[model samples]
Target chain A: MNSFLTAFFAGTSQGAIYALVSLGLVLVWRGAGVVNFAQMGQAMFTTYIASQLIQNEYSYWSAFVIALISGALLGALVDLGIMRPLSSRKNSLLLNSQSMRTTIPVIASLGILGVLKALAGIFWAGEERGFPAPVPTTGLRLGNTDLAITGFDLFVIGVVFLTLVLTTIFFTRTGMGLAMRASALNPEVTRLSGIRVGSVRTLSWAISGTASSLAGLLVTPKTNLSPNTLDLLLIVGFTAAVVGGLTSLAGSVLGGFILGYVIAFVNVYSAPENVFLAILIFLLLALFLRPQGILGSKEVRRV
Target chain B: MLKVSNLVTEFASIKALNDISFQAKPGRITTVIGANGAGKSTLLRTISGLERPTSGSITWFDEELTDKSVEAIVRSGVAQVPEGHAVISQLSVAENIELGGLFRKRQARGDLEIATKDVYELFPILFERRREPAGSLSGGERQMLAISRALVARPKLLLLDEPSLGLAPLISAQIISIVDELCKSTGLTVLLVEQNANTALAVADHGILLALGKVVADLPAKELIADSALRAAYLGY
Candidate 1:
């Protein structure tokens, strides 16, 4: 029972990290109508920036802030420099009749992933490095048993929850946030209504970048960091996003927690080596049951 | 007043708006009536800056609007209520309406409230259901929401594309009458694009007939309506 409790705590902690990364993916999906496969690359790169700053004796918060800003800039640059051109090309005469609208942006995002990975390799090489937890790592005692969740784990969960709350408020209450949401739904109508959807798209990417950087920073303390440290997390996050319904932010968070618990329980009951296979089976079952995702709206076919 | 001259908008190899030229005078509704392929929507799109014209000039109150951004065009008192009553279905009807005024400097929430109240005056049904998601609104209500949203910005020139696109004849007539009343009361200039020629011309003061991206005739609404042969040939009346 204690072991089960321990796994549950461990799963929730890990799930918190997945939620952060999943939120970033969901943001990009909503804003740009493109599933950004490059999220892991962006996260890895920004975390490295944070690591370098910390190595140079900068305070953790300062390093984190700087890394986040760098991530935002990187995301904006990717959208402006790479995604925009590809999008324009997709609309060009030769490609107008082509039915690969979804695939084109995806290919562009993959190119971004490659570029970020190469950049990280060139700058920092392929060394695995440990980053110290910003908060206390000592586990909370549960009736004399050392539980898996530490103070830092609690902090991560709190931060993820806080981020979700803030983003919810942003989209629901603020003007710009509403504009971003509306633009995601229909860019043409948004532009006609006097919103500069281009700027909104760029801003959405920047927000996603900042969230990804935060996710990277939070996850690195728990695991060793390398050039491709976040690749697995990216896949998990993508799965979570899919589980939550690709278009729904709240759904993504729920998906992440569900995935986290699944992995945790699986680790307890089955061989650790079977974790990936278990997750795949679970995802397959979920998708087979509900193709649009558990929380996704029914696809409205427009006339 | 809105003036568009020699506007040529091309999509790939096809010219959607071929040397289109027309004027929308202040305090009048100019209905651009055409068949589906006649470039009526394209003409409005070009003026609203959604589609760039290959060659032409659009002036709004003596200010050149060619090559300007959509937001810039809106700031210059042009607002487009796009085809299909394009309300942001996820947003509340009020939020969708407030989005109409987003081009202006960030107004206080109180100002937004007042602007919304004015729109409510125009669309009382929307006021009752302002808190609901726009998608929940009935088709006619959606059209009302769309028009009132554009009116929230209080623009000098209103560009409405296919306002009657998907509504029933009764609902379409209701929407047009409301628009005509709003135009008469506010002295607002309107450029209405429609495939529903009879209804559009009935409300409009001036009419321009379009055929395959070119102007077939530009005349007073009454004269155009009275011309039975022109109506039979182009409008299928």
Candidate 2:
């Protein structure tokens, strides 16, 4: 029974990190109409910055904050420097096809991932390093019994919940949030309403970057940090997003928990190698049974 | 007044607006009527800065609006209700109205609540359905919501493109009459574009008839309405 409880707590904490990463992916997809395949690369680069700061004797908290800010600036720069210029050249022969117009930007993002990974390798010499958790990792005690969840696990859950609440409020209660939603729905019409669509898009990327940075800071303590450290998390986060329906934020959270529990139970009962196979099966099931996602709205045909 | 001179817009080798020149006087309804391919929509797009003019200039009350961005033109007090009542479907009707006043100058933003209330008064149906998603509204209600959204910005000049499209005749007449009433009472400058010639001409102070990306006739509304030969040649009515 203790073992079962431990696995459950373990799954919940890990799932929270996946939820944060998935949330970032959904934000960029909704706000900019791109899948953002390079999200983990961006996160990895920022995590390295945090790692460097820690090695230089900087406090973890201050380094964490700086890494988030750097992530935001980098995200804005990516949009302004690459995506904007690419989208502006409408007369290019390579972008003539409707499919190509969508495909090219995705390809560009993959290229960005490669460049970031290469840069990280050069700067850090592809070193694997340990990250310190702010809170204690030992299990908490309830009377004489030790609970399966640690102080760090509790912190992860608390941060993820707070982030979700804050994000929800921003979207529902703020003017800029409304503008972002409006831009996502119909950018041209939003522009006509005197809102700067480009700025709103850049802001979306910034917010997305912050989310990714938060995930990196939280998850790195569980594993070693390297240029390729976040690559697996990206895949798991994407599966979570696909399960939740890419269009719905809350759905992403739910999807993350589902995958987290699945991973935990599989590890407890079966070989660890089956984890990837289980995830693949889950993704294929989601695609085949509900392509719009568990919470995604079906495309309504208005005659 | 809005003055567009020698305006030319091209899409590939085809000229969408070729050397188009016209003047829309302030505080009046100047309707541009044409057939499907007559470039009526493109003219509004160019004036609103959604599309760049290949040549010539567009000036509004001595302000050169030729090279400004869409947001800049909108901030300069010109608002457009694009064709097909392009409301943000996922947003509530009230949110859509609020979006219009979002980027208004700091001083003007104080009037948002009053402006919203006024639009509610103008279209009580929208008020009743303010919290509902805009996509759920009927076609006529959506058009009303679109106009209310543009009005919330307190634009001095309104470029309404095909407000009557896909609407029943009764609803269409009601929408146009409301616009006509607003123009007269508020002294708002209106450049109305429509394919429905008779309805537009009846409500307009002046009219411009277009064909194949060129203006064929520009005259007082009544004169253009009475000119059977010119109407037959271009408008097919």
Candidate 3:
């Protein structure tokens, strides 16, 4: 029973990090209608900046802030330099078809992932390095019992929860947020309403960058930072987003928690080696049962 | 006044608008009536800066509007209600209405509130379902929401494309009559594009009949309606 409790506590923290990463993926998908395969690479690059800053004796908080800013700038640069150009190539034969239009950007994002990974390798020498946790990692004590969750785990949960709340408010209450939602749904009508759709797309990328950066920073302490450190997380986060429904932000977060718990239970009851297989089977089951995702609306097919 | 001179819009080799020239005087309903392939929507799109003309110019009050961005054109007092009642279906009715006035720099909170109140008064059904998602609305209500959204921008010249596209005849007539009332009461310059020639010509003050991307006749709405031979030759009515 104590072991069961331990896995539950561990899963909550693991899920929070996944939620942050999933949130970023959903943001770009909703805003630009393109699945970004390079999300983890962007996160890894920004987290490395934070790691380097800390190694140079900078305060953890300051390094964290700088990394987030760098992430936002990098995201905007990617959109302006690569994604935007790729999307606007309407005259290209390869991009003229509807299926090709979505597929091509995804391929471009994969190319971006390769470039980002290569850049990180060149700059950081592709070395695995430990990242320090902002909060202590020692397990909390209650009376004579030691809880499985640490201060760092609690911190991760707090940060993810706060981010979810803030983003919810922004989307519901602010003018810019409303414009972003509007543009995502219908760009032509949004442009006709005097909103610059291009600017809004850029903003979406920036925010997604920030969210991914936060996920990177939070998760690095548990594993190790390297050029390819976040690759697996990206896959898991994407699965979570799919599970939640890519169109719904709240759904992504819920998907993360479910995946996190699944991972933890698989590790505890079975073996860590079977974790990936379990996740795959779970995803397949989800696809078969609810293809639109657990929270997604049913698509009304027009005859 | 909105003046379009020798405007030619081409999609590659085919010209959608071929040397289209017309004038829409202030405070008058200038309806552009045509068949489906006659380039009526393209004209509204060109005027609203959604499509770039291959040649010629669109001028509003002598201000050149040819190559301006869509957002810039809206700021310059031209708002288009696009075909198919293009409302953001996921958003609430109130949010959809708020989106229209989002870019306008209101001097005070009261200004925005008043603009919103006016739209609600015009479409009471929308007000009743303000909190509901726009997707839940009927087709006619969706059109009303789309119009209300454009009006919130407080545009000087309104460009409506196929406002009566898929609605029933009674609902279509209701929407057109409301537009007519708006033009008469507010002196709003309107360029209404429609495939339903009889309905549009009945309410329009001035009419331009189009055929194969060229203007067949430009006359008073009454005269255009009365000329059966001309209507048969061009409009196929």
- lDDT winner among the candidates? 3
The TM-score obtained by model 1 is 0.94
Ranking by DockQ: 3, 2, 1
Q: What is the DockQ of each candidate?
A: 0.59, 0.61, 0.61
Native-to-model Cα distance after best TM-score fit, residue A4 in candidate 2, in Å: 3.3
Question: What docking grade applies to model 1?
Answer: medium
Q: Model 3 over residues A151-179: C-alpha lDDT tens digits?
A: 99999999989988999899889888899
lDDT of 2 by residue, B103-201 (tens): 863677668888889999999999999988899999999999999989988899999999999999999999999999999999999999999888888
| Candidate 1 per-residue C-alpha lDDT over B1-237 given as tens digits, one digit per residue, 9 for 90 to 100 | 788899999987799988988888899999998887899888888898988899989999879999899988887779889888888787888888878877663655566567778889878999899888899998889989988888877789999999888899999998889889888898989999998888899989999999989999999999988898987888787
- What's the lDDT for residue B135 in model 1? 90
Candidate 3: misplaced stretches above 4 Å?
A298-303, B105-109
- What TM-score do all the candidates reach, one by one? 0.94, 0.97, 0.96
Which model scores highest in DockQ?
3
lDDT of 3: 0.90
| Candidate 1 fraction of reference contacts recovered | 0.74
DockQ of 1: 0.59
